[model samples]
Target: MLAAIVGRPNVGKSTLFNRLTGTRQAIVDDESGVTRDRVYGEAEWEGRTIPLVDTGGYVPRSDDPFERAIREQAETALADADVILFVVDVTTGLTDVDQEIAQVLRTADAPVMVLANKADNQEREWAASEFYQLGLGEVYPVSGTTKRGVDEMMSALVEALPEETDEETPDRTRISLVGKPNAGKSSLVNATLGFDRAIVTETPGTTRDAVHSVVRYEDQELLLIDTAGMRKTSKTEGVEYYASVRSEQTIRDGDVCILVLDATEEIHKQDLSVLTTVNEHKKGMVIAVNKWDLVPKDGGTMDQFTKYLRQYLGTLDHVPLVYTSAVTKQRVYDLLDTALEVAEKRAQRVQTSDLNDVVQAALRKKHPPSMSSGAFVKIKYATQVRTAPPVFVFFANHPEGVRDSYKRYLEGEIREAFGYDGVPLTLVFKEK
Candidate 1:
């Protein structure tokens, strides 16, 4: 079941969302309009998990472009939700904005339940009774900060939801398209899906949410997540700051990430930051040089650009790169194919015998450097401990004596023998 939390700005909708979902996924702030997009999370109550959407502040008669966009997002959530959580502030009595929002919820098809938030004291809880004049439904006095009265609200909410059904969720390879602002991440998504799956604008940070779309390519089902452009935290504020946080969460949830770069502009530090984030999470990645149609190219342009990127992507040179043009649909499908290949490589498992053979050969080629204490280091055997970001554990007589340089040598030999392209490898050394 899907439930949407909607109300005017700073009515504690995000606070309530975080409280129920048991996660700090939605950013809470004193500033109004902090949440400009629909943030999705799951709420577990009475052994049942209900999907929740926290929307931006709903402004009825706003002329601001952002406010209008926020209203549209809220309306979309309202249209699809099974239940509506209309939040109101009890500390401050009924207001004109609250009245306007209540009017709209009365006409909604879903059951509307008013949440009188900030009712920490008996006085404030008494003030919550005034909201009944809106005539939406039962007014539950709750405090999102203290989580008081939330259980009663959720218990009622779960009973109000439709009966559960046993439906199977399809297995999908989640591919996250992430990059700096206006790097053509959304355009790539629209092109790959052959439709406007995401709102594309010339303006930077147009997509403030991690929008998800499912598509079937060949025999594989893929979940494409188009995320907001990541900017340096020092320069970001308010909504954009939270947008960056959402993008980081998307990276952790994704199976493979496609780092989109504008071919016309030189790679920036922000782009490298995104790359490092994906690497640090140990997620499979593919580098996409977008807007190839706009770039002036010669016989060696691609080769020179590849070399330039390699310099910046020192250790990440193994990641696959595909030059694409969303406008002309040039190599757009190829990018998807490369991402799928990276996903497969991430899930690849190696046999114990094959793994040990490579480790033995690497040790014979170059012995591990000795420690300052001159303790002898002898590696006994190696085994893969995990897949989907393959991790190998090596047993050694003195694991602490293995040098970083020798570790790199062993990693190189393993990669040479068994390809793990576009996937991070974790090597653990243990004393036998």
Candidate 2:
């Protein structure tokens, strides 16, 4: 399922997005219209997973030349969504632009869910009720700070989803190190390989096209893709555009994407935008704070980095974060270790007997809820249907009512039984 989070400018959409994705994919600021492009992520609602999209904020009243382009982008996201999460500021009530957006969603033939955001308190939660007049069914009040109502909203979302299943697959893990110009992507790549195989240049965007090399570690061959630095879209012209396009294409092709960030400069909108693209591609991701040696060592940098990451890249929480100084080779190999661990987890496959046994044990520990029609939900069998990113299919009596929360419990059990570190798990509920 593909869910697009859309709303007017500065309604905390990016903040909520970071909370959900556990990433800093989108840049968050007091300024509106900062996010000029669409950002994407793969989000799992419990174990009923799906892709998520964070589009440029819709500034309905702006006269800026780019305003029209942003509107069109938002419209495109709406068109592509299996479901639309319409976010709104509960404290501010409904503005005319909000009404305009609601009207558009009303005409849209897609599944639309209204989210009353920033409802951090009881009063704000009550304030969210006014949005019901938009006619998008019940409004879900969520506080990105507290994470309140997020799980409930996700639970309802998973229940409303149609049945889907995954097929079996072999393990082929490819991890790509990617980032903007001069962000040290190549340095990180070389550090991972522990050799100077990848040429490191002082010039920005030195590495062009996709340079791929296979490195053997612990009996596993890791295909390391060192990509060119992606320039600003406006600066992307001729061969530069070709390089940027190829870099993005390479990111989508990889099983895991490691976004190398510069520690000296403040994280830019461009970096966050690239991250959004990675998440949208549904690739397991890790954010490496590259060039850590340059940081002032004022302390709290790691916490600050994580806080900002969570703030901007909402709703994507499955990614791993690492801090490394690629130039100093400090903790660089650790990043590779983490990447390999993630790759292994992503490529894992569990036996049918093991899966069934897990489900049986889970049910015995905590029973699933009864449906509204009074039928008890029963997971008859479960098995690993796929390996890449480790997708498991559950054969159940009440697939719809299995509940996202319960599915999360099952995934947790599977992880505990078989450690799938650094990888995202996908769970699909289907009838036998």
Candidate 3:
């Protein structure tokens, strides 16, 4: 379920990738190796989804050791990919290096799709015809900027997947701090590090790569991945599109995400899109409204903002929210405290005996509600099945009769018993 976009530098490989994935996850520049490492993003082609890797644009290097290492990384991407997108600039005719890539693709077990980008018009499209000589077959001349012939290209690519299968992913608690460009992500990291560890910059996109710093809070060391700024997928427009995809890797890697919103700007569609990525990851999350000092002393702006968040984010009502200014170090310490609290809660393990005690006690006070099936779920016992975003399983007769409201009640009771202030809990129903 992965496709690696490979080509020589400045061929618009990143641009084509960004256009397809609809994210600004990869840093694009006229300079080579601007994308120094592997960048990944979710790619949807013709309703079938897969991860798209924007590798560092390769240069024809059979000799340089550094170039060799980059080539190895690109080869690894090829090995891992379900399909390969070989992008070539229609503006520049194919070179020996392009043929070298073709030879590599011919040797690869994965299917290769030739994309002739920058073919903005029919004349350029005609110019793309020469790429057929590479022998990959059927060069699809398209424009990443204008998006011409993109649909056909995507359809052709989707049909080439081996099978519809979900791969087993690594289990890790991921917490992402996402916001618009220059939204104090680096400053917050500095405040948390208590030094100038993370390089702070006045210009945006300084932290190009996703930097992970492990910190201990309440005796537990947790990985905090500081991701780059994410813009709306629709407005991504070419290579900037890869940034959203690259930033999403942090979200996918985390068990929980802490969205850092700029308090100064009116919450735009882009911020919501970032949150949407967090939700799609299904990780426990908290929102840190950053740069709070800039906000005027309005009577109820905080309340209004909170209301808007809850209303828009819906069903994520349980997610926690905190406001702070990284520059002034206002409430910065509280952010870590809350993060630890949430992490511990996520890692909570409730014993079956303890769960039964709480559930039965609550049930005695208020009987398990009747359901539409005309049978009430008789809970015998409940226990924490897992930790790190704790998941609980309840053994019961007529488990199907259990309703969401009653489940919430049981969750509330458990929280009251354990005082999991910052963690999210998962409840499951099972027949005894």
**CA RMSD, predictions in order:** 6.2, 14.4, 11.2
lDDT per residue as tens, model 3, 352-411: 787788888988987887768677768888878787657788888878888888888887
Q: Which stretches of candidate 3 lie over 4 Å from their true place?
A: 1-175, 194-206, 214-222, 268-273, 279-282, 298-314, 364-373
Top-lDDT structure, candidate number: 1
Top-down TM-score ranking? 1, 3, 2
Cα lDDT tens digits, model 2, 30-50, are 798676544556667677666
TM-score of candidate 3 versus the correct structure, residues matched by position: 0.59
Candidate 1 stretches with Cα past 4 Å from truth are 1-168
Writing each residue's lDDT as its tens digit, candidate 1 over 176-241 gives 999998999999999988999899999999998899999999898999999999987655544675
List lDDT for all candidates, in order.
Answer: 0.85, 0.77, 0.75
Candidate with maximal TM-score: 1
Model 1 earns a TM-score of 0.66
